[model samples]
Target: MMEADILIENCSEIHTLKGPDRPRRGDEMQDTSKIKNGALAVKGESILAVGSDKEIKRDVEAEKIIDASGKTVIPGFVDPHTHLIYSGSREDELAMKIQGKTYMEILEEGGGILRTVRATRKASKQRLLEESKARMDRMLAHGTTTAEAKSGYGLDKKNEIKCLEVIDELDKSHDLDLIPTYLGAHSLPPEFERSEDYIDYCIEDVLPEIADKDLAEYCDVFCEKGVFDVEESRRLLKKAKQFGLKARVHADEIENIGCSKMAAELDAISAEHLVKTDEEDIIMMAESGTIGILLPGTPFMLMEEKYAPARQMIENGMAIALATDLNPNCWTESMQMVITLACLQMKMTPSEALTAATFNSARALDRPDIGSLEKGKKADFLVLDIPNIDHLPYRFGVNLVEKVYKRGEKV
Candidate 1:
């Protein structure tokens, strides 16, 4: 018999989400690769075997065993986009939006990203770490074991470095695996007069320092109409590549400005908030294999009727992922809530939403280690209180995650 470190047996259902090495697209997203009466063994941090209860019990011996009877197990959610390291709340801005103000209108009035930038810049590293740790704890409780966190709230060189450093510290100390991204081009700081000059400063002064410190794995830019245009975004992302950082973009949230095409041209790992992306750009993104990261929460919070064309993206053979877009503005950390919004607002099926949040989100981060419950993958999964996976989205506004495990250990 093979000796194992841990074993979970008699799970009512297991959505392994296992399939081709690439991200799932079109009809493939609906197929969850489920196992009935499932059981799995973990050896150290990796999954040893996954099969029927009888199959695993007969072949494996473990020091620890968890009887997951009547519970469903699935891969822990991978949230591909979040701005969880910021300081303070935007409830005041929320109130402003309620009184008939647009996001850009508020930004122009000095009350959007810059508002949080001011607070985050003034925050000490310990203060930032503490706040971020609390947010991550909430995310973990909701079954997010891994997430991609960007440092865009700090628009300048000093505070940007500080933000990334805090993210690194959090990653080392917390069980939640936090992937850091440098988003110095999130918006123009008060110091820079022109957007082009700000981009120049990021490429020349900020990015090299981040790269030297190995502070971030990815470099992201906000590629909207008023933020950074297509050409400016392209230049920043190209320079990011030169620093050995993977590129991601916040594109086409409010307008179709050819940013998605820029993402395809630059081969960005993913393009986020495609609520206003054009069909032509969507096709280019699909063909170039750039993952579409849809944030339904953004529109939901902003009170916008239009959401990302997620159903169309799926129909067009695009690999789609879902995220919370968890910032002070959006103010959410629950993947379950995001999944619910994806189903109700974006018209994705329950299975498709789960797949997007788990397997496809992992693909967005270029992480092959934690997306699925399969041999050679990290044993990070959620044991839900429900009997089946669909209940997660069906029973919206509830926390269904009974327990979370990271690398074969309960957390």
Candidate 2:
């Protein structure tokens, strides 16, 4: 018998999400590559074998075996966009939003992102690390093995580096794999006279330090109206590229001002929050191989009526991904809830939502090894109490993840 580290046998169902190595698009997104009575053998951190129960039992032996007889198995969720390393909650803003104050109006009154920045700046690294660690635990409990965490609340050079340092520490300390992103351009800092000046400071001061320390894999900008415009965003992203960091953008969330088009032009890995993206830009993004990362939970939490045009984007051959946008503003670490919001509010199918949350989300982060449950991929998966995949988004408002595994070890 071929020995392995762990064997999960007699699974009721497995949504392998095994298909092309690239992200799914158009008709391809419907294919979930499901297997019945499946079994998986893991060796160290990578999948050794995946097949029917009888086939795996005949082919392999394991040091430890798990009988998932009545459980469903799937690749661990990948959250490509999040601001999870922050100081405090924004519940006060929630009350204002509930009372019919618009997002921009609140921002003008200094009660949105800036409020969180104030708290985060005042917080010590140890406190930030503890809070971020707690959030990472919540993400793990929700079945997310890999998540992208951004540093933006620390808008200045010192505090921005401090936030990224905390994120790096959390990455080393937590079980969840945290992908760090430098989002110093998340907003115009209060000290800056103009948004351009803030963008210049990030490029001139922060980007060099981030590159020197190798703190982040990606550099992101909030390319929205009353924020960094498309031209300024391009300049910052271009400078970040020179430092060997990939580009990602918060594109077209509040207004359709061609941020999606700009993302395509920059060949960014992903464009997020395309709530107002036009059809031309949609086609452009699809053609440019840029993934569209949609955060339905943001709109849901804001009580906004217009969700992203996910159906249209999928129909137009765009590779779509879903994330919680987990922040003090959205306040959710549950990708399961994001799936539900994608289906019920964004009108995505269960299969599409699952694919978006898993495979496509990994692709958004440019991670090829962690999204699927194939033979060569990392053995990060979830055992669910449900019978089938549809039950996850169907039975919302509850945690269905029975257990989580990372690198072949149960966490």
Candidate 3:
């Protein structure tokens, strides 16, 4: 018999999400690879075995045993996109959005990303660490064991490095595993006259420093009309590529503007906020293997009626992923709520949303170890209060995560 460090038995269901090594596309997203009346054993920091409850109990002995008799078990969520290091809140902007101000309108009025940038820049490093650690605690409690955090609120070299440093500290000190991305081209800072000039600054100055420090693994750009346009986004991302950083794009949230197409051309790993993505961009991304990371929270918070054409993307054979887009504008820690929004607003099925939140989101961040429950994978998973998979999205508004485990240890 195999000795186990921990054994969880008699779970009503376990969504292993074991399938293709790559991101799920088309009909592939629907299959969650569920095991009914399931059990799993954890040995150190990896999954030892997963099978039917009786089979696992008969084969393995453990120091600690948990009987999750009526609960669902699933992989801990992997949020591929989040601005988790910012120092301030934007509650006042909620009223502005309600009073009929567009996101760009609020930004042009000096009250969006720039507002948060000012607050973040003014905050001491310790203060920023304190604030960000609190958010990480919230995210962990909400069942996100791993996430991709972006440094966009800090646009300049000094502040950008500070933000990445905070992320590094958080990763070391907090249980939520963070993959940092340098997003200095999120918007045109007030100090720069043109978006092109800001891109130049980020390319010539910030990119090299960040790469040398090994602070961020990915480089992201906001490809929007009133923000950095496609060409500017292209230059920054390409330069980031030259500096050994993988690329991600904030594409077509408010408008198409050829950003998704440009992302396909650049072979960005993922394109986020594809609210306005058309069929051509979808097909191009499918061919280029660039997954569309749909952020339902962003559109829901923006109070916009149009969401990403998820059903169309799925039908057209494009792989899809989901994220919180957890910035000042969206402000959500719950992947559960994001799943609800994906199902109700974007028309993604519950399983598709779950797959997107876990498996595909891992692919978005280029991490393969944390999003599935399988032998040799990292033992990161959630024990939900719910009895079945559908209850994940069905039991909306409240947290269903009864317990969260990271690397074989409960957290």
Candidate 4:
């Protein structure tokens, strides 16, 4: 018999997210690939096996066994696009937002990404790590085991490098597996007159430094109306690609500006915040097989009436994922919260949202190991208090995670 460290039996259901090990699209997103009366075995940091409760109990001898009773088990969430290394809060912007001031209007009034940028620039590396660790703690408590953390709040070379360094520290020390992204071109620094000049500075100075130091796995830019336009985004992403970093784009959060199309042409791994992306943008992205990471929390927090055309994207055969967009403006630690917004605002069903939150989000990060609970995959998963999948999204605004297990150990 196979020996195992732990065996969890009699789960009401288990969504293994069985996959061909790639992002799911169209009707594929609707398949949870679940097992009824399921059970799973964990041996060290990997899943040894998963099957019917009878099958697991018959085939394996485990040191510990837990009866999950009526709970639902699924892979821990993988948040692919989050500004996770910044220091500071933007609670003051709440009043401005409620006053009918737009996100761009708040920025023009010196409040938004740039506002956090200034604070992040001044924070010590230790302080950043401490603050970020707290956030990671909350993320883990809410069932996120792996996440992509971007260093965009520090817009300059030095401060940007500092933020990446802190991300590195947290990756090693914290339970969360952080994939670092250098988003130096997130905004135009005040020192430069033109956005083009700031982009040049980033490509010339910041890009090379980040690449040489091997600080980040991907490069991201805010590609929108008021930020880096298509051409500017193209220049930096191309250079970052040359420097061995993969591409991710914050495109069409407010306006299209052809950013999603540009991202598809460059074969960006994912284009995020597509609230304004139209059919052409959707078609091109689908053709390129670029994943659209829908951050529903963004529009929800921005108080905008429009959200990403998630149903259209899914219907058009584009792979869609969901994330918290965890930043100063939309400060949320729970992927559960993100899933709720995705289902309610973007019109994705709970099953599709769960798949987007787990497997598709992992594929977006290009990590194949953690999303599904397949045999030999990392044992990062959650045991939720809910009995079935519907309860996950149906019960919102509260933590549904009853237990979180990362790499086979409960946290």
Clash count per candidate = 0, 0, 0, 0
How accurate locally, in lDDT, is each candidate?
A: 0.93, 0.93, 0.93, 0.93
Query: Candidate 2's residue-wise lDDT over 1-411, tens digit each?
Result: 878989999999988999988999998888989889999999998999988899999999999999999899999999999998899887988999889999878888878889999999999999999888888999999999999999999999999999999989888888899999999999888899899988888988899999999999999999998889999999999999999999999999989888999999999999999999989999999999999999999999888899999999999999999998999999999999999999999889988998999999999999999889998799999999987888988999899999999988899
- Candidate 2 pairs with clashing backbones: none
Global CA lDDT computed for model 1: 0.93
Cα lDDT tens digits, model 1, 337-386, are: 99999999999999999999999999999998879999989999999998
Off by over 4 Å in 2: none
Per-residue CA lDDT of model 4 for 154-236, tens digit only, reads: 88888999999999989999888999999888888888889999999999988988999999999999998877899999999
lDDT of 2: 0.93
lDDT of 2 at 65: 93
Over 4 Å off, model 4: none
Worst 10 residues of 2 by lDDT: 103-112
